[model samples]
Target chain A: MGGHELSVQPDAKLGLHKNWFNKLTSAWASGLGAVTHKELADHLGGKRLLILLGLVAVTGLSAVYVAASTIRESAMEAVETGFVFLLLFSTSGGSLPSFLSFLGFLGPLLGLALGFDSVNGEQTRGTLSRILSQPIHRDSVINGKFLAALCAVSLALVALTLLISGLGIELIGIPPSSEEILRVVCFALLTIVYVAFWLSVSIMFSIVFRQAATSALAGMATWLFFTVFATLLAGLVADAVVPLPSEPTALELMRHQRIEMALSRLSPTTLYYEATSTLLSPHTRALGPISVEQLEGAIPGPLPLSQSLLLIWPDVAGLVAATLLCFAASYVLFMRQEIRAI
Target chain B: MNQGNVVIRTRDLVKRYGSFVAVDRLNLEIYEGETFGLLGPNGAGKTTTILMLLGLTEPSEGSVQVVGLDPTRDPLGVKKVVGYLPDRVGFYEDLTGKENLLYTAALNGIPRKQAEERVNELLERVGLAEVADRKAGGYSRGMLQRLGLADALVKKPRIVILDEPTLGIDPEGVRQMLQFITQLSKEERVTVLLASHLLHQVQQVCDRVGIFVRGKIVALGCVEELSSQLFKDEPYVLEVRAQPTTEELIRNLKGITGVDAVEQAGDTLLLHCMSDARGEVAKVIYQSGTSLLHLAVRGRSLDEIYRRYFLTAEEQTHRRAG
Candidate 1:
């Protein structure tokens, strides 16, 4: 309360209001809280959100059950060094895809749905003009919305991971090691970053397109392109750029594979998949195709946590850059947009 | 006729959307503690002008000083004291009335305890105490409008701007809204700028009215002053039902110095006088031995004045084009 007090001259007309610096900073800080609270509530309580949650939950629990039953039979080495619990959480078992795969596949839709209506919906509801009339800075609204959606995604991922870990312990009759827990936590964080990138992209579209439905369509289209078509496109480009004969040298084959991998990594989905796989499965030492000559004399074991983190550091950085780029574009656009409706 | 201190002043303010000028070089001054109505038809740029004044939209040219603060440079400074209720007032349909106001208070950086107290006070003031806890979506149109008013005044702003406040309200709701607006201006002593396309909507509420047409203020003054300015030279009509409506009476009435024309119909005599010559006309009628049965002054309504102003403006444009 004391922080809220200002030495504003009661009778003063115009200029900066009393405690101008305090007001500006507080507008930024509290604007975050105000918008985040409302948006988080909307995301958590929304009917569509419930449907998405149920879909993820049903698919995730089934994957976990299958992975847990298999691990129960081979609990000895699985629980000691390797990240078996984390593997159960991230890997597909039998025919069902793992929880992480489910997130990778559907997480963008959740992010898109949360943010596609972030700006234009306010305009349609007639609240954009009203909210902007307040003492807060214009950019704070977009900032708050992005942060809130990110927070919602983080919470959902955390809850799901904890549920999977708890169920794994109950079904396998063994608790995970400290390193395994740390790796799972990192995996969860990386997933949040990946989803947040999509959220930022959706919010940018929301700002650019005044119609919520159109922005939503654009977000889904982008997600589908990255997840489903990016690999095909990357393969086609690789073939054209680095065509290799059927009996090409091993080095030439490796060069062609490198080119294709680089092209595929342009999509955020590829980056997220590579990063999460390394973090969730300690045995996953490399993301690209490796020749036997390179691994002939190498000792085969799970890499240390630091080595694993180093392996995927670039992917994590790429996800972070993409998120910031989308958010920054939206911020500049929102600032330049005229507040008045034509 | 200038009375109160000037609280808001705009000089040659212009807003252009590409080549289409939304507001064209408009100058306006609003006084403190006065309900200034911005009267216009649809697409008259009333909303655009208000947005510029609020600093929500930047002006292409000229400047605006609200409460002596340049809104363009110090929008937060202007916004801290000015309250605006857009034509379509929207609220979070999911939240209760109290929660919505509290959210706005937090956005304005009010302390939590004080915000709660203020939200309660505003909810009570707007006559929404009983339904304060209910979701706004459940509220009626009139209730939502009332909530919108409370939301605007939640911070106890020194100036209030309402656009079409009673546009979709029922007749009873319209009356209540007008009463509330009048009270807001008079009792609170807050400067009010109310924009409406309906002439009578502002007729009783605004102390001064600015008639906006086609991105410009075509006529601006106190309603009475504007009426006089528009119809100053037009003869005042006096309707009199007299006992003897004869040619002699008409001739006598016509002979009065200021009387421009006198017409007789049945038992009534219509006197078109250049000035208010009721006394002289009465004397002439008395001298003619005609007993005056009833005498009434005929004046034009604000609606008629609004129409004529537009008509004259149109003629001027036509003349210029030709």
Candidate 2:
């Protein structure tokens, strides 16, 4: 007994020498690493990710295939424009909207699926209490799970985009310009941010609702409101707020369009669409209503890549801010929650 | 028992959920290397108190210190040396038992090589070595519990808190688990705080038991001390079995001065006495020409102690109400 006590004494004393900050940082780092590694492995190996990836891939490939053939039909014209690669993502072929539009519509589902059960599922499985009982900070669980899921989403998005680009190159026989490649990269990043915002929202719902099914339903409901109804709601709101006459003045017309744009931007889907459109089509110089006088001296040709990025900076910032806001909300709620065995 | 170092102490610790008091002004001290039982029934606030001690839930008042560190102020420091097995211990169903333990090992910051060795050792100790490679989803209830035990010990903690370790296991499994816990505390010299509503099961393992009722500890001490203190009026119970027993034998046994009551239960004579009267009762049976087959004194079981205490408390409340 005495020998056992002596052996354990050193470990107790070792914890006392370190300052609180150092102890906290080390615990947080170790915990974050463990949780992220485990969750990432689970995500990559699980059937859930495979199903979601399959859904997104099939739709994205079909859209890109149609766009590639359409771009091929006008191959000579597209080649002269130096942005045939960008057209692969933006051009609407037949009944299918562009590949970018397909992503804009489907990305939120991927985010929601990944995060809707993150916190609540742990509670249901009775692991939350066990995990929180560890020496790690409580916030590490949420942060690590979020980081892992984001990495999975990013990996999937990047791979899917690369695959489409490769196929487009084969179909059109036009290797992308450096600027076009840069634009595509920026477009992918913007999509990731938009998806991250939805991910955070779903994670927040997971923390708020105790049942995983309930949280998933809440997440899908929010997704439906934003993706399918937000645009129509914005149109109604704009019509009600700024009703246009048959021969409306230019200011009135601009006001109606501006109101509709602002209201629709409230949805992350709209922000993603606007940003991706600007990134993929450099000719998009203005997002909101612009006067004829403001465009009087502007050239009709495609703007530089820098100008396109500058035009879409606010949209990207909005997406990032929304993501951060949702993440902050979930963090606060999760940290404050009482971790009792349910 | 009090000579050992104080490993876990709480002063005026209270927890409340709005108007409901979960743990009320709890003051406790547990010594190092002792198996302490927090015995209580459902809704007695055992789980709440355990949570506060682990710093998973904040107390509404007062403080708790585990291994010389405040759990709320430095939970990492406290948790570093303390392992916990929650009430309904869960594991990732998809992951194998070894994988689950490894995850816990990683969470405790154990290196891969060291963690692997430690995990294997624990699995072997918990007797889950044979099924360590199987997915936990298919593990039996007893197996999952053993896995949970391995998970808790992954950190090699100095202190271990097990909340209802044998809540829903077969009788054989419960006995084995309790025996394992007793052997663990003895071998490792680890301070153990076991919370359970099953008094008899707790009696088998714990060195000291605290009877928690309605968010307060009604009694605390070793079983012998508590029994002696509560049953001072009749400190001993002796059971005598004899052949060719007659009415005169019972009458003579009752004549012993310290014997309180004598009742014939089947073939045995149960005597509630103020002293150990096994010798006197045996002599009386022999004197009456009744062959004394067996004579033994029965220790007070926790069930009787708990029932007697609860009855007295209820009577006191009833008297006050009246």
Q: Give the TM-score comparing model 2 with the true structure, all chains together.
A: 0.92
Local accuracy of candidate 1 as per-residue lDDT tens digits, A145-200: 88778877888878887887888788876678899889888988888888899999
| Cα lDDT tens digits for candidate 2, A1-342 | 998878765454566765566766775666988999999999999988889889989999889899999988988888777688999999999999888988988899999999999999988888888898888878789999999999999999999999999988887788998999999999888888988998999999999999999999999999999999999999999999999999999989989999999999999889888989988988888998888899998868898999998998898889999999999999999988876534
- Model 2 CA lDDT for position A100: 90
Q: Which pairs clash (backbone N, Cα, C closer than 3 Å) in model 1?
A: none
What is the CAPRI rating of model 2's predicted complex?
medium
Which is the leading candidate under DockQ? 2
Model 1 lDDT per residue over B1-322, tens place: 3487888999999999999898988999999999999998889899999999999999999999999999889998988999889888888888888888898998888888999999998888778999999998898889888888888898789999999999788999889889989999989999999999889989999999998887888999988889899888888888888886777877777778988877776666788887888888777878888788888666566797789887887788799979
Per-residue lDDT tens digits of candidate 2, residues B164-254? 9998899988988998899889998988999998999889899999998878888999999888898777568787888877888888889
Model 1, residue A193: what's the lDDT? 89
